[model samples]
Target: MEAGYLFLVGPFAYTKLGKRANADTMDRITIFCFVASYTLALMLELLHSWRGLIAARIGALLSGLAGLVAHTLFLYSKQPPLIWQFSWLLFVAWVLVVAYLTGAIHYRRLTWGIFVLPLVLALVGLAVLFGQPPERGLWTTYETHTLWGPVHATLLLLASVGVCVGFLASIMYLFQAHRLRTKATPGTGLRMLSLEKLEEMNRRAIWAAFPLLSAGMIAGVVLLSRSEVVSWTDPRVLSTVVLWLLFAVVLFLRIASFLRARQVAMLTIVAFLLLLCSLVLSHNQPTGG
Candidate 1:
C-alpha cells in the first residue's frame, strides 16, 4: 500500500512536464515501464504463493528498478522545466504503479492497469496532440505575464489527478462488488479487492480530493478576478465550476452516507467519472480568455 501510494504521488508531481517533453517517446516509455513492472510483480507473487517471500521480494525489487529507470528517463527528457505540473504528473504515475504492483502481489487484487493504462495513454496522447504551441493573444499573454497563473493551473491539474484516482477507485469498487454479488471467483488476469477495502479507498479518496479540488477552483477564480484579459465567463472558468459542483455533490453525499459504505463508494465513483468528463470537456474547449 505504501509503495502504491508513493508511486501515484510521484507521477502527479511531474504532470507539468507532460507537455514539455516528447509525448510519444514518454508515452511509450511509461507504458513499457508499467507493463514490465506489472508482469514481474505478477510473476513474483505467483512464486511467493508457492516458493515464499524471498522470491517475491526479489521480483518486486527488480520490477521497482525497471519502473524507476523508465520514470527517470521520462523525467530527464523534459528539456525546459515545466511549471509544477510536471512533478505532479510524475507523482501520479508513481502512485498508480505502486497501487498496481501492491494489489497484484500482496492481495492478488484485480489488475487495475487494464482500466488505468488506457487512460494514461489518452492523457499522454492529448498532451502530444493538443499540447502544442500555446494560443496567441490574451490567454497566452495572461499565462506568461501572470506569475500566479501557472501556479493556479498546476493546483487545478493536481486536483484533477486526485479526482482521477477517485475515479479509478470507484471503478474498482464496482467491479469487486459485482464479482462478490455474482459469486464469481476473480480471474487470473485480474484480482478483485475486498469490498470493504474498495469502499474505504473510495471514501478516503473523495474526502482527500475534495479539498484540493476546492483550493484549485478558488485559485482559478482569484486568477480570473485579477487578470486583465480573462473573465469569469471564460470556458475554463465555467467548466471548472461545473467540475467543482460535481465534486461538491460527491462530498455532500459522502458525508450524508457516512454509515452506508456501499452507497458512498458507488456515489464517489460516479462523481469521479463526472469530474473526468468535465476535465476532458474543458481541455477540448477553446479559450479566448
Candidate 2:
C-alpha cells in the first residue's frame, strides 16, 4: 500500500514541479530581452546601409524575426489579458515590428528597418515609463472583456497603427524630397520609395485610419456610457476626439486635392504628434477597458 501511494504521489509531484518550472522560466523573460534584440537589428541595418554587406542585411532580418518571436512569447506569458496600457503598448510595438519586417523583406533594397525600428524602441521605452500597473492592479475582465470593449480597443489600436505608418511615410517623403532638392545621393546602400509612392502611401494610411478612428470613437462613447469609472469629459476622451476630427479634416483636404503632397505630409506628422500626446497623457488613467 505504501509503494502504490508513493508512486501516485511521485507522479503528481513531478508534474506540478514541471509546470512551476515552466512558469518560472517564462516569468524570467523581461521586455529588455526583445528591446535588445530590436536594437541590435536596427544597428545591423545601419551597418548594412553603410557597408552594403549582404551578411549584415541578413543578420538584421534574423534579429528582427527573433525579436518578434520573443515578443509574441512574452505577450503570451502574461497572466492578465492584453487590455491594459502596458500590454497594449507592447502589442502596438509588435505590430510595428511586423510592419518593418514585411517591408524589409518585400523591399529588400529599401532601408525600412532604420525608420521603423526607432519608433518600436520608442514605444517600448514609453511603455516602461508610463505603462506600469496601477496599485489596484490592471482592470479585470469584468470590465475589459465586454463585447464592446475589445471592439473599441481593437479599432483604436488599428487606427493608431495606421497613424504610425502615415507618419513614417510622411517622414520618408520629406527626407527623399530634401535629398532630391539638394541633388544628393542616398546613403551607400539605402534606397527609398519614390516621392509619388510615399505620398500615395501616406494618403492611403489616412484614408484607412479615418474610418477606423470614427468607428473606434463611436464604440468608445458607448463603452464609456456604460462604465462608472471614466467619463466622456475625461482628457483622454477629449484628446482622442480631437485626433479624429483632425484626421477627418486631413482626409477631406487630401481627397479634395486642396493640399499638396508636402502639405499633406506635414499635416500627417502633426496628427502623429497629437496621437503621441494622447497616448502619453492618458495611458496612466483607468480607461483600459
Candidate 3:
C-alpha cells in the first residue's frame, strides 16, 4: 500500500514539473516568434530595396502584420494587458508598423519600409534588452495600469515617431546630397524622394514632435507624481529635458543662418540618438519598486 502511494505521488510530481517546463519554453517561443517575424519582415523590406517585387513587398507586409499579431498574443499570454516594460516599446512598434502598412496599402508607398523598419528594429531590440519582470516579481503601482500609464506611453511614442521621421529624413538627405555631388542619376532603382521634399518632411516632423514630446514630458511628471518609486531627477527625466532643449535650439536656428542644412540634419540625428540612449538608461533604475 505504501509503494502504491509513492508511485502515484511520484508521477504527479513529475507531471507538474513537466508542465512548468513546457510553460517556460512556450514563453520563450513567443518572444522568438515575434522577434523573428520582424526580422524576416525587415529582410524582405531590404530585398525590395534592391529589386522592387510586388510579391516580396506583399510578403514583407504580411510578415510585419504577423509579427505584430504575435506580439499582441505574447503580451496577452504574459498578462491580460501590458505588465512588462518591453510591452510598451513593442506596442509602439506595433502601432507604427500598422500605420506604415495602412499607408503602404492606401498611398502605395511600398518603399517606406526602408525608412520605417530601422526605427522599428531599434525600438524592439532596445526593448528586448530593457529586461523583463522577474518570473514571479511583477509588481507595479496603479499608474502602470491606469489611464496615466497608457497616456504617458502613447504620447511619448508618438513623439518618438516624430523623431523617427527626422531620422529617416536626415538619412535620405545625406544620400541625396551625395548623389547630387557625384552627379549620379536619381535612378528608378533608388526609389527616393527629392531633397526639397525630404527636408520639408524633416522640418515638419521636428515641428510636430516638439509639442508632443513636451506634452509627454509633462505627462511623465504627472505619472511620476503618483508613483513613489520614481524620483524627480531620474536620468530619463534629465535626458528628456536636454533633448527638448536641443530641439529648441534647432527650432531657433531654423529661423536664421545659425546652422546650415547639414548641421541641422546632424543635430536631428544627435537628438534621436539621445532619445534612444534614454530609453535604455531608464531600465537601470529600480524596477518593480
Top candidate by lDDT: 2
**Please, what are the lDDT tens digits per residue for candidate 1 over residues 50-115?**
454565656655665576567666655432122223343444555565555555456543454455
Query: What is the overall TM-score of model 3 with all chains considered together?
Result: 0.74
* Candidate 1 error regions (>4 Å): 1-68, 79-95, 102-110, 132-139, 186-189, 258-270, 282-289
Candidate 2 per-residue C-alpha lDDT over 177-211 given as tens digits, one digit per residue, 9 for 90 to 100: 88888888665436789899999999899988899
Which wins on TM-score, candidate 1 or candidate 2? 2
- Clash pairs detected, candidate 3: none
Sorting all predicted structures by lDDT, with the top scorer first, yields 2, 3, 1
Candidate that would win on TM-score: 2
- My TM-score estimates for the predictions, one after another, are 0.66, 0.86, 0.74
The regions of model 2 sitting more than 4 angstroms off are 1-21, 134-145, 186-189, 286-289
- Cα lDDT of all candidates, in order? 0.56, 0.78, 0.68
TM-score of 1: 0.66
Worst 10 residues of 3 by lDDT: 2-11
Q: After superposition, how far is residue 51 of candidate 2 from its true place, in Å?
A: 1.5
| 72-120 per-residue lDDT for model 3 (tens digits) | 5565445422324465566667667776677557645436776777777
Evaluated at residue 169, the lDDT of candidate 1 is 75
For candidate 2, the per-residue lDDT at 107 reads: 94
